[model samples]
Target chain A: MTVVTDGQERAGDVRLGRVGRGVRVAVALVGIGLLINGSVRASDDAWPFGPMSQYAMSVPDDASITYTRISAQTDAGTTVDVPLNIEGAGVARAEIEARTGEIVKDPSLLQQVADGWAKKHPDKPKYVKLELIRDTTQLVKGRVVGPPTPAVLATWEVRR
Target chain B: MSARTVATRAANWFTPAIAFARIAWLRTVLYLFVIVDMHAFVRDTRLKGEHPGLYQPLLLARMFDLPKPTVFNTTALYVVLIAACLVGASNYFPRIAGWIVAPAFTWWVLIGMSDGKVDHDHLALVIALWVLPTVKAGRRGRASYNDQARSESAGWVIRCVQICVIATYFLSAIAKLRSAGWALTWPGSAVLTWAIVRRPHPVGEWLLHHPWMLHVMQWVGITAEFLSPVILWLKGRWQLFGALFFLGFHAANTAILLIHFLPTVVCWLAFAPMERIVPWFQRRRASDSDAGEAEDQAEHGREAKEQAGA
Candidate 1:
């Protein structure tokens, strides 16, 4: 092949290899859009370009996550386990659990959590009390499920 | 030759040319990582596709009004993503393959992140994927070039990624400011306890007692984030120091939190002298060729001298 030294042609047919004025303008516009998209207005799924906001804010001193079986008294006064307390949320269970810990200290937030829960399980009867009882399971990482050591961390209560 | 030295090359404004070998090297690393990343999610992705009800379209997906995320759709998208990465990495039909890699991987990222567990660490990587295809990089394995063809465009592509790296840090600082109340009383120290209670490791437990240290780390993290843009403008030792500092930041983050931004860290190659490897090799090749030419000239000189005597 003859030597072409004008610094523009490639043997391959790649689109941007030639670097035209239009391509440069397009790249500049795209770059600006990318930089702005995430920081200005990130979409619901995820903004790869936005502010790295995860763990950006500080967790309060009293903030903590507890693994416990939440129990609530049914209208019939029978205590039943709140099944929504735990599931297959890898690592995120901590955040949910932590939020529960927060609601325990500040019962005023109970209405929001309850409203969301009611929306999810519309059929379940309203409970009189919400208490997270520690599971007596020894947590194992990879193998068998160990029993959580049961401990109670109470959050909300109904006078009725 | 007008590309100048490694240290000055990036500084050259609008230097459109780039070494093709560098493109080849970067593509291999990026394509492999993107492929492996998708591979890890194959079963999960396929599951998402199968369970159309669970397929929550993210903003981009919603805007595109993509077809329902049926098991067929999810799996098919991944299939395309993986195939594009493989063919692009292998450069089987290079130009076509290169064009295929970016959008396929992008679609996979949007789909994969639809569950609301989005990580911004891969944005620079995605940018890399898109920008990389623009350059007509040489064959795989080689990392240097002897020609000026396409060097300018490669430079532009790499510059875009480098900016992304800087943006990650620069914007992270902005994020911290938005939330971190900035005083010593800022409960940033509580993050250790917050994370520890979830995982309950010995080191984390120990650190919990040392709240003051966590506070110190918070200040350090913010400072590092704010100063991160130095990687672009800083020269010589300072630039290297900035890079090392960021690497340490990632390392400490992974060690403590078990969160690794492996892709973004890999994209840090844009700031590094990676493209220089090709230029160095090219310099050696040129020198060797020059030496060979000098030897031939000397032999002809000797022969001509003999003929003159005759």
Candidate 2:
């Protein structure tokens, strides 16, 4: 026998069921916990349970990304720009970004990359000349302010 | 208001609106989106860009020792995820289905996102997706307020999702400010500029010429993120405006930097008074039903009268 005073609350309220209520409270608490934890940790990797530190900082408009491009030559001897299909090799973007960083630090890896490609695809024709280039330009706006001044960092000859 | 009062109000605010119909629609759309996400865009195994050798498990995957999925495993996980999503959507063993989706979706997201960059946007949706099954069931056409059977659970789940949505922006603001330095003004601009260049939008080139615009975007973006939680405290039209503003923010983010936060947008649906639409639809249907019944009775009476006369 329940009497409504201020309010008895709704009957058959599924949220009140012990298990359902417990789950609801637990989930809400856990969500709060994660939100706090994520905020405090403040790293890119922590994710939903962590700080969403994506693009937290700014860089100069002139800040440049050292990108890798392979100019692969066809059987007809026409050279074309080839994107580094890192995912195709089962590598993550972070790993690729790291590798690019490495290339900038030590220019010698460019030859190793070219040779590895030739070994993997012995049948396919490769760029007669693979050049690791530093194309310094105003690349931020997606509109090149000037020609990509290709400063050849390193070069490797691909095996025919 | 004091902290306790605020907490009480939040609790009351989330007190389940009759959510059976509203939740049903959201759940179906969300689960289906997950299925499509796994199959098409983010398929880490057989479909799309898959690199088994390159599957570097992030902190959680490594900590939990989740399977380093091969082609077979990714495919298997995909099938299981699709089944769970379908079952959950259909409301057959919804808890079991939801349970399965949470982990499967986590796994799917981990494998897909880990390949390139791990995104925080889908994280909240994962939390919401799992908790949704804990909500009580309802008739598709019934009004949320009138439902006496298994009340409030639906609202609790929906409220949890709203909280998750808030966290996405609120926490993001905290993270940005915590590291607020020279980079906030500079690197932020550089990042967006680089992104536009990489993904060549029609307006990206136009935007590049105006470097000052980048700075304005940066400050405005962080300010919006910080203030987003205010919507929770606001009432009625203000809440609607707040919600629309955040949606616009996400839209701007996608258009400018090509940063997609689609799942977070889906979770935003929780903030909407979606239950009202269902009741409105039901009223129309009810009126149509009553009219048809009246017409039938009138036809019967006319026939009876004519027969008596004859």
Give the best candidate by lDDT.
2
- Candidate 1 lDDT over B114-172, as tens digits, reads 65456668778888888787665555433222222345566667778877887877776
The list of candidate 1 runs beyond 4 A from truth reads: A1-26, A40-46, A64-160, B1-17, B41-43, B138-150, B180-189, B278-310
Kindly list the per-residue Cα lDDT of model 2 for residues A1-160, writing each as its tens digit. Answer: 2222111343443445556555566668877887787777645555548777776655455566444454545455877654554332223234445455555666554454444455456676654665555555565443346644656655555544
Q: Return the lDDT, model 1, position B243.
A: 85
True-vs-predicted CA distance for residue A78, candidate 1, Å: 23
DockQ score for model 2: 0.33
Model 1, position B121: C-alpha lDDT score: 81
TM-score for chain B of each model, two decimals = 0.78, 0.80
For model 1, residues A1-160, the per-residue Cα lDDT tens digits are: 3333223434542334333634664665677576666655553244555556666666655443445445667676788766542122111333335455465666654443344445456676767667656543222221123333567766577543
The lDDT of model 1 is 0.59
Model 2: lDDT to the true structure: 0.62
lDDT of each: 0.59, 0.62
What tens-digit string does per-residue lDDT give for candidate 2 at B1-310?
A: 5776665544545554333545766677788888777654455444322335435567777888887777678778878988889887765566678888998888777777654466778766888887787665665322332222434666677767877888888877776666655134432456566666555678776887776686678777788887887876665677788888888988888888777788888888776655455344445555567777656545433322221100
Residue B60, candidate 2: Cα error in Å is: 1.5
